[model samples]
Target: MDALLERIQSPAHLRQLSPASLQGLAVELRERLIETVSKTGGHFSSNLGTVELTIALHYVFNTPEDRLIWDVGHQTYAHKILTGRNLRMGSLRQQGGLSGFPRREESIYDAFGTAHSSTSISAALGMAVAAQLTGSQRKAVAIIGDGALTAGMAYEALNNAGASNCDVLVILNDNDMSISPPVGALNQYLAELMSGRFYAQAKKIGERVLRNAPPLFALARHIEQQTQTLIQSNTIFEKLGFTYTGPIDGHDVDGLVATLEKISKAKGPQFLHVVTRKGKGYEKAEIDPVTYHGPPKFNPSLGVVGAASSKVTFTHVFGQWLCDMAAKDPRVIGITPAMREGSGMVEFSQRFPNRYHDVGIAEQHAVTFAAGLACEGLKPVVAIYSTFLQRAYDQLIHDVALQNLPVVFALDRAGLVGADGPTHAGMFDIAFTRCIPNMSVACPADENECRQLLSSAYAQDHPVTVRYPRGAGAGVVVEKSLTPLPLGQAKIVREGEGLAILCFGPLLYEALKVAEPLNATVVNMRWAKPLDLKILQEIAQSHDRLVTLEDGTRMGGAGSAVLEALQDMGISRQVLIMGFEDQFTEHGDPGLLMQQYGLTASGIQQRIEALWPVAQVTSALRRVV
Candidate 1:
């Protein structure tokens, strides 16, 4: 056991320590975080960044009573360590263990359950409102990153908070890097040179003078306002109704603690702009936060490393296709909402610097920005996570789909993303994206298909989305040559006598397993939107039973599509739908989750076994009748 880990018994223990002792504790905590997280493989860089800030927040505020909401929640590891979760840190992100994100169920200190970005303000505002209504003397503090503030939702919350005049403290953790370092800092910096004590005192003196005097004081106040604006211009945040505070060094614990303590007593909505490095203490992560954002378990000394096999992932397939497509067509433009490394755009970005756009952590902006780019002759490809794309649904519909703009949306993590849990799962893209008019959705069965579909989406001038799951491909050799296949068509993987399994995306692999034993015909329904009716009708006429399977939500998924197709055709074939139930999946290993959901090869085979016996029994009953 680490001696440092033992010292962090509680936040109270943290409060008692002097500045020098706390600094030593921070180093110890950083070492413990590195050792455990390197083995457990949770979020690294952001947690490393927020160590001192977390310590200061606890030291300054009365937590459990005072609400503190972390924007992304991954950065709350240090907060968790301080708030009586130090022992459970080793089991971070594991099943039945500490969550990677903040969980209200786990501790009272975790005021809100969070994983998605830019939601802390809204949640914190709600907490403030609740406290006000209940007559609870609890202060609500929302710690948000400048990157998350780029999202329109954050501004919406700020507008509401300012109008309501709720006593909420919003700390903007600005590092000029909100996941990616390319997003430079914005806003004023008077608080940088002047101490918080001086600023507070000056504010009091100005208010007193303004109350007593008339003409000369009014003139002085106007001059002072102008001077302050020139020195520390009222940025967009202040205009929205927040009392803008800082661009302070977030790493300075004593400075942060003192500032927060002073501001905690203030009576209105306050915004503290504290800037810190992303991968603060660890040099490797500090230098390359984007790459080290969510690295797998590894030896910390060797630095973060990728898989040795160089197994071609679906993401890699997209990357190659993007670079190749951009090379061939100058009009093709690539855009990502600050996911350059994860979405596999590094090579393409390097190759076509002018054509590629990293639109910070603003999904809404990314969509509209791409839509504007599309108004010209440029074909914009917005690569984003399936879960994150949920944020841009309105933008996609209003800006792209309604206008019928040529925006190729590459939806990454288009299935059950393991370990990240319900908030991170790509379960609803099929249901949600399908609802938009003039929108085309495609899912690939393998790596080769993923490349070809992307090529197809780019070739089309209308709004098209191609979604692919995370992790490596099905080991299918992808071709360098790009070709657009006929739209609304499904391919048959095998032929059978009785049962037909219609599988979409990743479920194709498992469906094949069920098919191999039972000799069932399997159709890889590549397109999720335009249901492949020709094959569906053919199979309905031939097979007595049809099984539809997918990795997404069962509601309005590929199974539902097949059922709708058969219903529209008036061909009442006995169809069995299989996929995720209408429930949020918990965090676990991908394989474990798959098995739990009965979406695995053996699990599918067991279903086939039960159905095979039923088929025989039904045939015999027909003879008896």
Candidate 2:
């Protein structure tokens, strides 16, 4: 039985398996996924949920030719396994290995790359339209979750797709989740759509009754529509011109295979609503899906035993600051785009439920909504990931920054976020946010500074973004009080002659380590936007050479800002900027990525040695002595 799964090198091989063998293959696949993912620590519960759906899709469709687009891409582990990526599943999310999400370059089977949510419908529609233009018989299937369907983009795609007469099949994989639990009116609507017995009964009756009579087919459809309108309300998909079908059991492989087979041959934009449970096979995951959503490495037999560490993460610091901020300020409100837990807003959400807004998977809406709240004299704190914030760049600029709304963006994962890869990396935040006119970007050196900077940002009149890296900082003691740091000030951490190392964010630690050997002065430049010109002038006057260090991209980043400031002041000794290269950082251990990108102490030391040789420095010291 296990050998059957081994034979499935590709979807072509997958189609060869009998319907009876599929269930057995599915069992084997599930076991393999659990075994591999448990050690590799890839997306857990979502992948577990979609095992059957993935199998059914490949089994039914001529994938690679028939484009299959996965919305959000967390559930595509099974799809990857079926499409000749099973062998490399162990290296999932690792550097120089398979991406956690779908990548077009990675394989021909991956029709479109997807890391973000609500994009499958649009991508699938485009593929279908492209096929139509080329006169190809290929189909485009979009497997979107109810969670992704919450976004307005999905609806917009649905509207356009319905109007265009393209053959795009949208399979709603309703597991009632995104990263966190599904929320808002859309989830409720989906629940209603699933539970409505009248619609289901009427649909069955109409199909049976209409098949016998050719002339009364239109009348039968009319009757079905009337029944739906009266009982279940006119489905949004139906109104948008999709032939809707089923709250079908997604776990039932034979049923899914049969349904998908029929739907493949169907005309126009079709929507098949399939109900699924997150972590269907694994009991531990089923009991608590959120915890198992993206768990670290753990033994499957023993259950989730999280790595024991007393170290406080930057996320925890943000969560503490959020709770404290909400407690003191009566007008303070918290917001996240379906990232309550991820953004460290779970406690804030629990404590101040009224003030907390979880605008599900709608980053654009979340930003503008925060602006609206700010307009109403509410100090809205938008706790969001740096990667996710890219989606709301227009809203941040147009609605918030342009208006100079008093909003605080507590941007978590503001640098090379390990494991999630380049798509989820926060490398662009410093470059992106600093360029905006009314935006003030703060880079904290450590956890304590992170808290202080957050408080400082909240007090500001204009839109302020406080960006912090993922995971634990440099073991700095976090202060309990929310006293703000001096705005646009650089703190000289250590005074030394010859060279200056100007650091931004938590990369200050690495700079300090590199500076120790070089006897370079280390300055923690707190704010990225409002360059500390006074401190820069003093450092420029004192040091023969200056090195700017940051964890973001070198181009248009904090280092670039420093260079521009130095140019404006007409004080250029010799400047060397160090940060991420002009390329997407691959998925790997954060420390390894830092080393590879020349952000680590050893890497920085080598770069500095290249600029001013250690031998030359020693000779200069000897001559001076």
Candidate 3:
């Protein structure tokens, strides 16, 4: 017989299978998921954990017509497979391949696109309200993890969703982990809710009621309502206007299907708590789900092995610098919004347990919390991703920058992050941070500069952001001493004639390569906020043409800052600004993406030659002469 997974074309096919056959389909789905991810490398444990739930959801729900939104969307591999995308699983996160997250453009089954966490409930509520307005019977369900529930937006949506009494269903997939182990009062409340005597008593009461009652619809309703009332007094969801159900076993496809069927017919907002284990079927992943959360391609039999790399990543440099800085200054505190592992703060967290704060997935609270610490004479370093920091823009401006608080923001993954796509890219950090008053932005060129600039930012009295790319840079040897670089200063690395390239961040290496062949002067503009006017004037006067390069967006970016400064300085040199255009970049290899965007060395050379053909010809003639 053909495999159950091979025969299924869509949810329609999935729904056709017998209740007994559904478990076999789940087994096949898990096998397929493990096989594909072992080769392609993606959200492993989360996707593995969601297999049974995905099966149950698709089996029970009408799908496509009935909207399904996956929060953080990393665990949607099974969802994709069931929705007629099994063959394309091989291309997951590859160049021009399937997105790791749910994208509306990818399929109709992906009702709402999500990469960032805690957005599903809000989006689902909006869709549910829309359905109400249109007089449709289609249901909307938002499946969010417990880690995502840490965000305030989820509660804000919950408050509105409850009061509105819409047909939105919020399914809490309580896996007891987000990216990091789940934290906060909510997590504690959930643990208590699951283990408390009330839940146990309610179960006994319901079971006893079911045994004695007549096999009628009214009796079933009476038992359900009675058991719910027992549990409702203890639940926060019930108070928020939701009919709370379960702390049920998510892996039991039969139970999930039965429960979902019952909930589907219920009126008003619904909150179902389903407990699942991360990396449920896989033994190795079950032991250490975090390491397997997003591992590289590896053999499933051997599991993931730590492969040593010669190159030091910027994340490592930051982590090392953080530990060193903390040792020297007792006032130094490290904080991350549930990205302690991602931001390279494991060592710091281990060494300074008291000072280390993982503020869950709340970006807004993290920034304000850092600001509050700074007010009390403690220096707080908020190590966060460039994209994630966008969530706390208002907190940054109002709490940190407005007060001129000395909060050092270590903006990791500051530029085009490979594979994660535009949602995770740090393209706007340069433009966004520079515009804010009292917020200085530093663009480090290499690993050594990253450490030095971090020190410099730390030394400042006001809020400063030191932006660095995702991976390793030019492999510059980092200095052991804690030394601060001069703030708002540019360094001229090379001197040549005809053209000068002002490079920012890690793109300095690419600029150097372009400059070598053209004999063009290269200046590493360290700061994007306080433009190096003295160096800009000299570069402008000495060179016939100027070019600005960065890894961020062209509009209002570091390149734009250069142009604005030149305009103010009354310099008439023909300047060409080069950076990412005003478009969201796609998920692909970083090197390939850079080449496609004309940000690589050869690509930069081609653009320069094309833009200034006459200048190139004149330079060639001069060299010949």
Give the winner by lDDT.
Answer: 3
**Cα error of candidate 3 at position 319, Å:** 0.6
lDDT of 2: 0.89
Q: Model 1 Cα displacement at 608 (Å)?
A: 3.2
The best candidate by TM-score is: 2
User: Which is the better candidate, 2 or 3, if ranked by lDDT?
Assistant: 3
List RMSD in Å for every model shown: 3.9, 2.5, 3.3
Clashing residue pairs in candidate 2 (N, C-alpha, C atoms within 3 angstroms): none
Tens digits of lDDT, candidate 1, 1-625: 5565586677777777776676777788888789889999988888888888898898878887898999988888888888998888878888778888998889988999878898999999999999899998899999987367767688889999988778999998876566654552332232233334455457667878787778878887788788776554566678888887776778888788888888999988998978788888899988888767788898989987768876799999999999999889889889999888889999999999999888777898999999999999798999999999998888999999999999999999988888788889999998888778888889898899999889888888798889999898678999998898777788998998678898888779878877867778999989987878988888888787788888889898878888887778878867778888999888868888889888898888777667667446342111100
Residue 61 in candidate 1, Cα distance off native in Å: 1.7
TM-score of each: 0.91, 0.96, 0.95
Question: After superposition, which runs of candidate 2 have C-alpha atoms over 4 Å from their true positions?
Answer: 213-222, 615-625
Where model 3 places Cα greater than 4 Å from the true spot, the runs are 197-233, 614-625
Candidate 1 at 448: error in angstroms?
0.5
Q: What is the lDDT of residue 41 in candidate 1?
A: 90
Which 10 successive residues of model 3 have the least lDDT summed? 616-625
Instruction: List runs of model 1 lying over 4 Å from the truth.
Output: 2-4, 16-20, 184-226, 611-625
- lDDT of the candidates, in the order given: 0.83, 0.89, 0.91
Arranged by TM-score, best first = 2, 3, 1
Better of 1 and 3 by lDDT: 3
